[model samples]
Target: MAGKIRVLDPDVVVKIAGGEVIERPASVVKELVENSLDAGARKITVEVEAGGRRLIRVSDDGCGMSQEDAVMAFQRHATSKIRTAEDLYRITTLGFRGEALPSIASVSHVELLTREHDSDVGTKVVVEGGVITQLSSVGCPAGTIVTVRNLFYNVPARLKFMRSPASEFNYITEMLIKFILAHTDVSFTLRHDGKDVLCYSSEATGGDLRSAVAVVWGSDTASELIPIELSTPKVRISGLTSKPSLTKSSRSHQVVILNGRFIKHQGIALAITHAYQKTILPNRHPVCVLRIDIDPQLVDVNVHPTKAEVKFANEAEIQRLVVEAIELALGRTIVVPTIALKPQPKPATVKALKRAEDAFGKLLRSKLQIGTEQTAQTDLTASKTHAVTSAENVVMVTTPETKPSEKHVGIGISGGELVDWHEILMSLHPVAQLHKTYILAEAPNGFCIISQHRAHERIIYESLCQKETRAKAVQWLVTPITLNVGQAEVNFVVEHLEAFSSVGFEIEHFGGGTLVVRSIPAIMVNQPYAQILRDIISELMLEQQMRTLEELIDALRASVACKSAIKAGEVLSIAEMEQLLSDLSKTEKPFICPHGQPVALTITDEELRRHFER
Candidate 1:
């Protein structure tokens, strides 16, 4: 059988392993960022061109490695972070695997320029396709600068899977945001094609996380945060969250960190969503940045090669701690009133009026005063001629009493004050709530529906969303509420001060794990403020497991809708129903509310007839 198969090349085996580490541009970004963090770089800069497809440059002012260490860095599994199997269980460094550098070098053209602080000369190395082509001594700054080019050149299939430059850039930006959130004390700058996208500088204050977040996300987000400080024998949790009203339609805004490492945890996300339940609409997400600190032995960071997900020894306890922290922080904040505003009606078009006239010609014409003067003039002329022929200077003419045509009358009412109301209702007809959630009204052939809550939610959402980036309008409360929480919950509250203020909740940290609440969301002013906040937090904790802050916000909006919606059994007057119908007709997606639930239902005339069997 010719001794089975020929032996595989060692170079090919290395190249295959490289494929596992460097999958895409985002993968490259992750490796480079981790390397910078490991280098003890207080400041780092990343620049990309062509969405990192053409070039990727990372420069850092960390204590550069010696010539020997720099040369050994390109070898697989060569790491200073770990010495044995036990070290893997307790990893503190960001890039402990050491495979990232070697793996990356195997797949692309890489150039490294690094010099130790004590060395007068730097070492330069160039590697292409897993082969070291050059190594030389050169004079350079006391730092390291790595440039990678032509990624996946050997693998055409992988290159083909790359997305457009814009999309790839978005991914890079997202990765940058994660790093920025994780290491707020480290100043970072990012540029795309020589254009600065982000420039963050850490603050001397302990809240560098918030400062960094404000720079990348916006100042408004920082303002909405309520300070959270929580500690326990087993765990510590802290971070910020957007108020229920500041929900978004996407998860782009949520950031979570586990033990100083950025990660995406479904359990934590679901907890946040649970907290915002009944406060935000469905499908809407909120803005949040949370960090969890726990004993190193309690969590496993080696579950994934990328370390973006982790398994905790006591996940349930961690979840409880996080939820409790957020709940307690919210309880201390004052609840303010949120005013709902009605949307403006669209102006009537000439075509619409013409259509109405065509449907009921004489009735519409009479009601609108169209051709009325001409009819009166013709009647007067005929009466004058008849009067001239009369002998006693008075015309004794028999005239029939004119009755209004049914077709000429508008819909709803016959006459009196109800006439205007009837006309308005008729003009707004073919009204139906689409998806049983939003109201849809006929407009020419097509129709529009209103998302009663989302429309209101959007308005509030926008205001709160902006507060994270800009100065927000704040309302004061008359009474200050006190809330008691554990240590970990306090940390979470402090992390999200700006997010809280944006939604009109004002709070201050009182001594000994107590928060003083001064204001709350205006919409929920009449309700039990403390209890509502507590419930929201509890729900947030539950939701954090499955959703991000943005998703949680949506859940909260739905919660608010349920509490504020018109009750099902309540009777509505004709005018009230008409108004509701008209409003529903104007909405964009009136058939469905923020949640997936329908806002209204419809029974066709045929279906009604069938049901009655008339």
Candidate 2:
């Protein structure tokens, strides 16, 4: 056989290259728009029909090309950006590969009309299936306009894979939004089916990122955005990040513009996420429009034809920069989310609830039993001053088993109720907090014990969902605390005092690099403020990089749920136990803590009889 790798046919080579560069109508729009931007276009207009499968037209008021250059632009690997090996390493322009036009023309009928800045008439060139069909001189505007008709006319396989018209149009709109965000100075207009679908006017924005954000996202998003600006010797990072209260369910709203082109870099994305991990609620992503301007020579954009991804010379440093900028902005802002009534999650289906009720139905056949062991330190006395009398208690009562189909009231959503635990727990009369670690109460189904720490954790986390959550809830300490620490720690606390203030610590600069704490978080009112403040400051010092203040604050708040929780061995009065039970009942998840630990357990009469062999 002839040499197996003999030169392939030109048409086959063209198809192979086109497949890599042009995947869909959105790909065509991205390439064409980038080309217009590279030409220094002040104002550009894009028109599409049938989601760019039938036609696509891009017109730009840029310095048009000469007659000779207009024809040469169609040739493969021909570009004005770079010509040598060294230039390839530092490609600056977006279309330096020079394959967009040739690949696009190879499958579609394309017409190019252009005129130079000083030329009297423009040049018109027609291309079909990568061949020159006609050429003429015509009177036209002092700019370039390219018309592409019937995309994938010769490539039926590619056309077959195109998405629905609306889906394809959405892809194009998203691409245009990225461009609009990155290039605020240049006006852009996108027309679909001859109707103006999206437009960004240049005169109104004055090249502001907020204006771009308002146009792409709504004005509400723009107003909530906090500006991020950080400049190093080799890196410049700028963007608009949402406040702690503003978050989204998906990362679709996040974009990173690197070196004038929007791209996907995993390290950069992770950096942004890591910064916001504790700042926003779990599973919620912050709306980000990060722009990284770095030296072009340090980036390798030649990894792919589409340039959707890039390789950075020093990715770690870039990630650090991203984190610091985000953290600095967040540290100065309050971190409570929008608070509303926290509705209880949907309960198990009726069948599922029945199964559970049936599994524990053995209790109904057993007699009411009361344990005499009081070693757990739970006082079972009637306290008239506590508002909970012994007569109102369910500990010694004979309660009929609730039918699985009976309607029960809950503290959460309207017309919604829990099946078992909620019904039993809310009817509980507070006996005492057991050993100061567990809570003992007289439930309708005998008695139940609750883990004090775990119950309080659920209460704290659920409070974040309800009204007046974590923002500015202050508890003035009876005595001001004066903490002595290393100078660096003191300086860090002083410099980032807003971080402490936002989390509800009213601290003032005490003389000689010490801080005087006058107030503490409402949640930590029972805890020792001096020790906790020391621990908070000490933990902050261990962080080598600039972690988001909110991240650190979140860690502290989470720890508060544990360290500040009612200890197991500590004693609880009847009144405190009553209040704790009431607060626990109000939470969406009264049975589980934020860490998935069980908060409460029912001591059924059946189980008690089995222990005593009654």
Candidate 3:
């Protein structure tokens, strides 16, 4: 038998390596954003159409490249940041690998327009599938504008794996947010399809991360963040942490950066979380932005192909530092204002007036009592009042009135009323509200309680979930919305077209890697379709290797529930609250939401009495 022959082409090797570099539009985004940062760009503007499938244009007012350098940038392993192996140890620039440009160009149709400040002329280069189709000198302003299109066009297999535009767009936004937090000195703008999604102006307060966070996340959440600064010989840690009251249900709000590079490290995240173990409720994550700056030699960024994960030389020490810093910061007392009670007037009586006069002596006491009496009549009976008096023995006399039915009445309990305990308590019929959030109704020995909002959420969540599963209705648009996507995303849509239809999305592929959305699911008609499609694609792509279609569909439904659920602090009327409580009582798992957060928490009358020392 003849020996088996094996041949490995260099082009095949290059293409395989390229796959690791350019995985999606977000990958391209990461490279471009890093490049802008490395070039010392103070302001970077990223504009994407069709979730960066049709076009991903990054314009930066950084030091642009020369004609020769622009042409060389497309070649594999070409970089200005590193030269020899030793240079890697002290690497500071974000795009040192030099593989980003060539890798991106190899997988997409790339157009580069760049000009240096010193040069009057600019260079324009166009590359498709690693082949340079055009290179010319042109007149242009100083800076760089990189436009990537037709991603994964040559690799049909890879193209088939791209996520929906909305999903991709979210990923892009997440990446942008990371960069914005990391570099507060650099102004960033993100525009999608001619509409601006985010705009951040550079802060004058010496690169405050809080300002950037306030711009991206709402100001309400950002306002609660407290500053943290710590330094040691090996590392420096600085950032902000949200107050305990502002914790979120998910870890999405936490932002961690290692040496100005955004990273996803479970160790560091767990360290911060462990520090806050008891202070924050279980399942609730604190909002934080932590930046750790250590010597470059101590970190190995090369460990991950995406460079989003790094290995630290002294992880234990780093963890200790992070934990200690967070713990110390949280231990400090925070002053929150309490409602002030209104002052009340003493009852006018000869004996009371004589006692007051004796306490304060004649002249001062008489004047104060006269002023108090004048203001007493203006105070409404229903208004809250606080009384200041030295006389300990006080009595109120009132005529007995007909008692209402014990089963129907609810009254507030007073401390002194316990003397005639049985008679007063039986007549009062005061019901306990759990956590001051729900009412507990008595029914002989065993009692049923009602959840105010959870009941409402459960009813709404189940009804929506059922509607989603039974018969999803499509809301057709009079005018179709067209979105440009990468060739890969187009392939993904084609592969999952039937699934999309099942979800009541009327989408058809337009020529040249574009999708025209004619209708959305009736449930999501008001939602941004581009964003919804992108989210669906991302969900599908993330679990493509691990889950079946049915599992993915379930995950999608959960996401919809999470998005549509009524948030906390929404005021409800008595009828609405009652309806919500009734619905919550009907749910199988009435105590918890789908995300595993407590829908309602109950504190019994016994527990309340213990707390109040009753």
Which structure among the candidates has the greatest lDDT? Answer: 2
- Tens-place lDDT per residue, model 1, 1-614, is 57878878998888788887787888888898888888888888999898899988899989898889998999999989999999877888877888888888887899999998898999999999878899999998888999999988888988888865645665676688788888888887778899776667764534376666666655545666676668998677887777665655456567888877898788888877766665677766767788888778888888877778889887877777777877776776665767645222221222234444232233222221112232232221121111122232221211124343322221212112212221232354444444444445443322334444443332333333343422322334555776654222343455445545545567787753466777665444334556465445434433433244455455554554343344333333333434454433333333344544444332334334567895
Model 3, 1-614: lDDT tens digits are: 97688676866776787899888899999999899899889989999999888899999989999989998898888899999999877778777888888888877899999999999999999998888999999998789999999888778898777866766776787788889889999998888889776678885535677767766664555777888778999799889988776665567778899888999999999998998897877877888999999999998887778888888888998999999888778777474745435222222332344544232233222221122332233222232222323221121211124443332222222322212212221222225555655555442222344444444444434544565333423456666767554333554566567666655566898764467887655444434555556545544554444345665555555555444333344444433333344334434444445544554322345445667884
Q: Tell me each candidate's RMSD, in Å, in order.
A: 17.0, 17.8, 18.6
Position 91, candidate 2: lDDT: 78
Question: For each candidate, what TM-score against the reference?
Answer: 0.60, 0.58, 0.61
lDDT of 2 by residue, 114-231 (tens): 9987999999999999999999999988889999998889999987788656556666777888999888999998898997766788788888889877766656568789989999
State the local distance difference test value for candidate 2. 0.70
Sort by TM-score, top down from the best: 3, 1, 2
Model 1 CA lDDT for position 322: 72
Task: Identify the candidate with maximal TM-score.
Answer: 3
Candidate 3: clashing pairs of residues: 53-486, 159-488, 166-534, 167-534, 167-535, 342-386, 455-584
List runs of model 3 lying over 4 Å from the truth: 1-5, 203-206, 335-614
Error of 3 at 6 (Å): 3.1
